[model samples]
Target: MTGEKVSFGFEDVSEEEKVSRVKGVFRSVASKYDLMNDLMSGGIHRIWKSNTIARLNPQPGELLLDCAGGTGDIARAFVAKAEEVRQRRGGEPAMAIVTDINDDMLLAGLEQRGDDGLIWACADATKLPFPDKCVDVVTISFGIRNVVDIPAALREFRRVLKPGGRFACLEFSHMATKEMQAAYDAYSFNVIPQLGKIVTGDKDSYQYLVESIRRFPKQEKFADMIKEAGFSKVSFTNYTGGVAALHTGWAI
Candidate 1:
């Protein structure tokens, strides 16, 4: 370790070792991640995630990869929708594989969701383990912010997706209006970490949560990055006055 160090979010430490910071965070918060999310977003994350599932339009015999699938919420959501589709259209559900770098979180997800053998893997988003053009759809809800390199992850998502595959990312985004921005910041700073303390007994992890959201790329710039990753028809839909945005693209 060097005497001098660099900043990783609000803390300053380690010039060459700041990047795995997110892994540390998720490790610390893994057990209570879902509970804290419910407390922090007031269950609105469910709505945002539900909307993302809708945009996906998953069909039978398709494969879905839910990256950073912490508690398997997106996988469950996809299965739920697929079941609904099956009721009317009458077919099997799409395969939803939940992958996360943190084993603790992935294990909890596996435990909670109980398996349909819906492939769970330990992997990095920037360097996925799947073969090229193997998945029909890829979704990473609130996962990209923790990635050290956003652009590389975008390219990887595109790579794993089959031709014309769909990619939907649900992430915390810049608020649309000044008033909403101020309110969002206030709530983020004051309320969220406090909930983390009360719920997960971890405040610093939640503080980093707030900071990462602030540091994430803006809406249009991120869409541009997706396009640069060789995706086509990139677009984003801002939800709740841009507090969260769903960016969509198709691998061509």
Candidate 2:
């Protein structure tokens, strides 16, 4: 059943349908996504994201390839952190190359953030446009689960990294406590889409957001997938009691 195709949402779907559905969700929720992230997580996403940058151990003169990096939140965070380190050490600044699979998201980022050393490209995660061993670090946040092929994307992350390059993926993960699951489930199933409808006028797309998290590979299994992709020193750190997890691996 490993290769058996499944659709997004609760419906049974062919692989093609899943792709189409996910695309629609991003397009529909593009404008409201950043806001929804704040609302749904009660601003904890900022903490989760901040923690991700902290783990990157950002360094100067390093090149960061940000995958599925919509709106450049990770890019902004990286730039800020990298700049702070440079200021402290009086060294060169790190560079951030923002990459995303969606044009609307990329364009929104460019229009909102402007060109301040942030590079934007419309590229798929499974087919990254970079040379082998090219980037010093690769990071994907909240966007990997939206990918059509997780394993292929993982392999691609490995392929585009320099020797000893770092990879960090921050994603929604299964909840840790059984007591919390029901509350989370009820919030996801009943409250989330309704909140979306009230706020963004789009309920179905938010519904997809809830379901995709459930469909994602659990934490340990995902670490195994990263290892299988030829990444050494693969490990994960759970956050907010497993509401989200950050997986880090090195290409060695």
lDDT of 2 by residue, 100-199 (tens): 8787778777777776788788898988988898889999999988877888999999999999999999999988888877778888889999999998
Q: Which candidate comes out best when scored by TM-score?
A: 2
lDDT minimum window of 10 residues, candidate 2: 1-10
The positional error of residue 44 in candidate 2, measured at the CA in angstroms, is 0.1
* lDDT (Cα atoms) of all candidates against the true structure: 0.85, 0.87
Best by lDDT: 2
List candidate 2 stretches off by more than 4 Å. 1-4
| lDDT (Cα, tens digit) per residue for candidate 1, span 49-116 | 88999899877777899998887888877877777788888877678888998888898877766776
